[model samples]
Target: MNTFKYRQKYKSNYFEGWYIRLIGKKNIAVIFGITTNKDNPHAFIQYTDSRISKYYSFSLNEVETTNNSVEIGENKLTKNILILNVLDIKLNIKFLNVKALKKNFINNSIMSFLYYLPLECYQEVIYLDGEYTHESDKGRIYIEKTYGKKFPKEWIWIQSNSLPLTLASAKMPLLFNKFGFYCLFEYEKKQYIFASYKLGKIKIMRSGNTVNINIKQGRYRLELHLKLNNTVRLLGPTNNGLMTITVNESLDSNLSVKFTKKNKLIHQSTHKDIGAEVEMKNHS
Candidate 1:
């Protein structure tokens, strides 16, 4: 799980970003990204809370990375701790009881064998508990990283460490046609994984302000419904630069998830603080 994903040297048409969400009394997300497009190479930090969203950019030379951490200017993010020092905000948070995905040689990560393939984009998710200065501001946290030449044409991410679930799917280009792939991970008593490589049937539907998604793999099934709320525009990475792609994200979205085995229900719950992101060209 401690794979080095950040770029140390400048490269053309490449970008890597990490989405670190601190889900507590005041939900905050600290996003770090670096785009190496010869013409416009730089690093950035995007800070978002319940009320405001801020972005800071710097030169590529200011970026530092290790196998499990990335630091841009005064902001730094790792597997266990995150430090922020931008503007008047100063925070030092530590992640406790961090639960990461098991890694193997053949199927490196949650993406299965595709983690080693030369895809346009790759994503990895991690769940853990976080603590800051106040106890009320210490709770569950969700972290995900993406690195590649570019993101998929369309994609949706739904995650909640409180619910301990994450579902990410995208329409990836293959030659001239496009194929869909997804990974549904839920941890109740144990981790349940339903992914494309596991012969799963995944469907995503958009209706008005809500999106419905269903996944079936073997005898286990997962159903998710998300309603967008407090949606805001955020910067995403492209081959050109970090600000070229627009991402619609809602940190406090309404989400309902149902997981079952065979014909028996395993878990069903509704959550108000779900991290949801939708990046699409148009509504279908």
Candidate 2:
């Protein structure tokens, strides 16, 4: 598949980016984004680790896309390998036991029917669970991509490779007000899902730096509670420009998740380190 299809079409208010997370000795995240806002269309990269974070900008022409790879300047990303050279940091990482989403009606894309329709923002999962190695430091990794005009005003994103779970809820444009969705596997050796179109109900609550989410669909229920820790601000694309710190990602956060079926516990996990980005309607 052409993961970089949006990059070729130079349209106004268009943006595409790949989110790459490398969990090794230190949790690290890299964002490669290209925006075509007419006035200021450029390609940029953002980096964040436990200690420091930085951003780099280049002309749009610096971005190169292929069948399965996207390269910007000296950095390159593919399904199997990732090469990076920014500032003093360097890595030549290789993904192992990579698991891509199945190619089917619902599994092929997370958006389901909404994927065919044009929306402000569309997200795709490239890799569900994978392992990475960079010399002596080795850990888990997750890969995904987003292409559209701009991000949602409010959203919550959380993922854990150890649990092989990913959940997201965003304020989508159009008839839908706010949508909550999740995809998970390897839970008691079974696959369970909760999505907007699946006739699921979700409730979100926020108090200070802690947030809790509950989703119920038929006989399945998933709950996620998190407390922010070691967070760093990251810029996101907007109609005005790519200057808004729309995302504050927590590198190492406390997360506890529960999955149940038929009013019985199926699986549960607690992790001290996880990847998350959350924005609530009312935060006190």
Candidate 3:
């Protein structure tokens, strides 16, 4: 028997429970495998506004585990992948050998995947890199939904057909947020989708001089090649899915971004139609 406990919080929804983790250390199976629609021993969830907890929910990939204590091939087994049936949906997952448990369940119990969570399945994730030095400046970014304790780093981004801007530590001047404000630049009416992290990977498809952002979710991985191809499509786990985009760009390289999940076809960079001035103004 194992135990797992944790708390989950959302702006609109509420969830925090001591779930059960089941591992079959009692069995003598050589290799335990599984399939699932959620992550191993855990599930990813999102919340919606103006709704109850059940109404605003979604899930992503899942994991399963076994208790053979040996390295086995990733395949299905003749056992029930899930030990607990508390979550709304049921998915398949496998295990190797039962280890520790979590949430009143097994801790770090290895499992296999039968399916993945019902993500929007964007087929794309773009990674952005930068630092956030100011409070007000950071608040201006609509990413507060994903914000955490720190200054809020590790950006996930998306963009339009226009040119994309890359911000380096050297390119973006250190900013102050409390009292002062500053102007971001736009070199040629381009757009910028970005996030930041200590390190991660990026995959993209480039056509001619311009580059297409297929996935932009985390830092760069030096050991692995970051490119989108038929053989290697899934870019792996990101910090989160929230992404940002700068609708306006020019040579000055200042960042004016509106956090839209989808890229809008028309950009209002003009004084009237574009509302460049009003766009810059963010009120509490």
User: Which candidate ranks first by TM-score, i.e. highest?
Assistant: 2
Scored by CA lDDT, what does every candidate get? 0.74, 0.77, 0.20
- With candidate 3 superimposed using the best TM-score fit, by how many Å does residue 95's alpha carbon deviate from the native? 1.4
Q: Quick one: best lDDT, which candidate? A: 2
lDDT of 3 by residue, 1-284 (tens): 11121111222122221111111211010112111212222223221111111211223123332331111122222222322222452223333322221221222211101012221111111111112212122100011011111112222222111222222110111222221111112224432222222121233333422222222333311111111111101111222322221212111111233322344322323110110111122222
Ranking by lDDT: 2, 1, 3
Q: Which structure is stronger by lDDT: 1 or 2? A: 2
Mark the regions of model 3 whose C-alpha exceeds 4 Å error after superposition: 1-6, 11-80, 83-91, 97-222, 230-284
Q: Model 2 off-target regions past 4 Å? A: 1-10, 240-243
Tens digits of per-residue lDDT, candidate 1, 187-232, equal: 6556667777778888777876688888888998888888988877
- Clashing residue pairs, candidate 1? none
Model 1 scores a C-alpha lDDT of 0.74
lDDT of 3 at 25: 18
TM-score of every candidate? 0.90, 0.92, 0.19
Instruction: Name the regions of candidate 1 deviating beyond 4 angstroms.
Output: 4-10, 104-108, 128-136, 175-179, 240-242, 281-284
